[model samples]
Target chain A: MTGGRGSGLARLSLNQKTTNRWSVAEAVQGCVRAGLPAIGLWREPVHEIGVLAAVQLVTDAGLRVSSLCRGGFLTDPTATGRQAALDDNRRAIDEAAALGTDCLVMVVGGLPTGSRDLPGARHSVVDGIAALVPYARERRVRLALEPMHPIFCADRGVLSTLSQALDIAECFAADEVGVVVDTFHVWWDPEVMTQIARATGRIASFQVCDWITPLPPDALLSRGIMGDGHIDFRGLRRAVEAANYLGDVEVEIFNADVWDADPDEVVATVTQRYLDVVLDG
Target chain B: MTGGRGSGLARLSLNQKTTNRWSVAEAVQGCVRAGLPAIGLWREPVHEIGVLAAVQLVTDAGLRVSSLCRGGFLTDPTATGRQAALDDNRRAIDEAAALGTDCLVMVVGGLPTGSRDLPGARHSVVDGIAALVPYARERRVRLALEPMHPIFCADRGVLSTLSQALDIAECFAADEVGVVVDTFHVWWDPEVMTQIARATGRIASFQVCDWITPLPPDALLSRGIMGDGHIDFRGLRRAVEAANYLGDVEVEIFNADVWDADPDEVVATVTQRYLDVVLDG
Candidate 1:
């Protein structure tokens, strides 16, 4: 059962699942065939297909670019590594600008190599974002900082909660730095709804996915498909929409099972499920 | 190549190696023989030897009871399940009171069964703890809320950040609630030091362990022994001690590999490691 009938379907956007199976062009075409309105493109896919070509393909497919998959890996204890990450983020900003995407999602880096200095890493993230803000603002590209789950605190992203991300966003001037509300990451957060309300106008992008049972060894890449796992997407959508986030609701799944399935089938199943449960709610 | 040459050897704790092979009595005797000052006791071992008996064994041996393994699983969506958890927690508080332990550790339950309502579960936890606080205070037993990693957000603990736990603790009067700072769980927190400072006098327990590479399926149970994982316990110890927490530095490990070893050997290794790293540093 959906969250009260007649709530209406939430918008559907496809995040190119982080697998090498489907090319960017193919994924965009698949979304079109499945009747999905938007797509969240990853950097590697765009890089592989060439930024100009990827942009052209999205434009041709008549699909909205919900977000650019990532932009930040800011935690580099060393100057060399830090500079490199900032430089890469600059490139991502350029790519997002080229694609005419809604925003560039940021997965702020976790602890620096060989160290447990969490605060140090976080400081670097704030600094990295601050340094990139001017350029991002100039290009009119929103930097959406996506707070990962605490499981990724060691090797992935240091910003592990919606409140933490919002704090970082608040440090930046308005509109330049925004927050990305991804259900897979923040669904378990106790303050998620409260933070979503606080994030109202600051929400650059919104993503949806499910949390599965029996966590994987590498949880960063083991998210569940929309209806296959246990998350109240309709409830989450209602919260976000209540906060006045009119941005596209992107489906970002990182599951081996779905990747192993037929790509077209995956798209079709997700679209139908989204329409039935989330949108129709 | 440790934290510093003068820092001395790494201090290891037996928690990283618990696979249910040792009894509480055996582990305590082993720690004393190995010259380790403190030992963390789990519930099953206490139950096996009987609470009073275990407490007597440790006390008579001059071994400090660092912190009770756990006491909270407060979130249960159903009234019966919630009451059952609180009832069990009451028993745990009584046991801690009898053990003369520093604090009763609480691993607050995650999302309620078959439900993805994280906030609801968290509220239940607060209510559950508020219910237990009076009983614990009456017994003069301090409650230390240990925030588990976000990976456990679905099935284990809803409170995933030290800040979140600290906030919950602050809800109660200062003396009634405190926190168990486990390096394995909080090492990746972006606000680790700041939150630690905020938790200064409120810090009830400080547990040390390691985070090994290539996490396994049961990541929680696969914790690394001190010095074997990535955590810098010496630095962490300094932070906690700096916070004015004048308590035993409990060596709490949950490693599958260490548990399979002989209990005596496990104790000996952990004791030596703890002396070499923690006390030496």
Candidate 2:
């Protein structure tokens, strides 16, 4: 299983954060054990392993780097604050390039502290991304602007719709900046299917996770395994495919139950669930 | 105080659900005690006193009914399910008319059980409204479709955006079918301000409630006091007012903490919060 030869999942990637307790090495090993050809790395875990070593671990395990988790949170109101966020994103770009991942997912930050200027925050996001595009372009790391669910609009990502993200992405070259089609973030959108098709070559990454309800006190961990939630996985997968997005379909669950389980068993369970919900269902 | 002649809040209405524990009479008395001229009625509370008696209770107290809580759950899957939902809404229309409230709020149901047909559910909502709009129009009760937060799309309301609600509401007369601009549900939309303005005469109600983070297990109770959460109440109120929405600005909060507090104190605190957040702040 360590060879990751085949479960017929050439496009499946085990996003490390889905197994919150796993080390970089553990996730790479588990992905290989489950025949997942790729892995999506979060900044914290990559920093934990040192970028060079994390890259080596995945490469040695014969796993591809699907995408680096994030690169944007530019909703600050001050010039100094904006500069700091852009500088941080430059480092994230460098890390993505060094790790051999072309896509650096951007979860644009929400309203600046003590301010309720959503339009201003969104402007900050566009300007911030515009400022970083040249730097990211130089590094060949495409900034994948991910529009998180509207619930995360306050504290996490202000890009709450694929159309909103795409509108910003339209300001730059598609290869330099693009949008991520994350099922958990976008399944509720009325025009998601149309937007996905419209995204076309601008599709930077395709992330999959189911949206489970009765959201816990922390809504962040409400994501569940595919079949365990309400998303029409097959429908979304078809939309992504129709968009000509050939990137790895990264499984990125944030549920406490999935994270609390054994990484190996968790990987096996999710892979099967993905097949059942996305491919076979 | 029961005269409800003045506290300088002619445009304010205290929605009963904000103080979930208070009965219809208690809510009517509380509103009057707080010098509030209007109160939004829920179906349950009105049923408790019989709609006619409840109507008399508010009228005798010289307080007005701003809007009835709801009349839509039109997304159920079966023929029986759809018919039952429409029938129930018909009764709700009668109650709204009996209560002398022109606006009957609609919290359209989410995807039906064991179903992933969001488009189908949305169609059902439109059909259900079309079937009832004529009846509501005849009775002089306008259907005020309330788009719940996107997070509730799976299990509560499939109509998750003001734009989506407007798209459906446009099929009828603005006065006969309109949309409710609830800050808690729509503050996250990038186009909310623009949509609010575009809604114009179609705006039926302007409900204010703050969007609190780290939602409780039941996201229903995550609403906070105006200043307690991240919403731009002044901004929203400005937009709603600019839309020419001259109806009552209802204060509706659903939180365990708010509900657990003394209802009288809750009303006073919320009314004061409204004065600060919407009028003064």
Best by DockQ: 2
Model 2 DockQ vs. reference:
0.74
Considering chain A alone, report the TM-score of candidate 1 relative to the true chain A.
0.94
Identify the runs in model 2 with alpha carbons over 4 angstroms from their true place. Answer: A1-7, B1-7
Q: For model 1, report DockQ.
A: 0.54
List RMSD in Å for every model shown.
3.9, 2.1
TM-score, structure 1 vs. true: 0.89
Question: Residue-pair clashes per candidate, as listed?
Answer: 22, 0
Clash-forming residue pairs, model 2: none
Collision count of model 1? 22
Q: Report the C-alpha displacement of residue A256, candidate 1, in angstroms.
A: 1.2
Q: Pick the candidate with the highest TM-score.
A: 2
Q: Each predicted complex: what DockQ?
A: 0.54, 0.74
Residues B111-175, model 2: lDDT tens digits: 88878888889999998999998999999999999998998999999999999999999999998
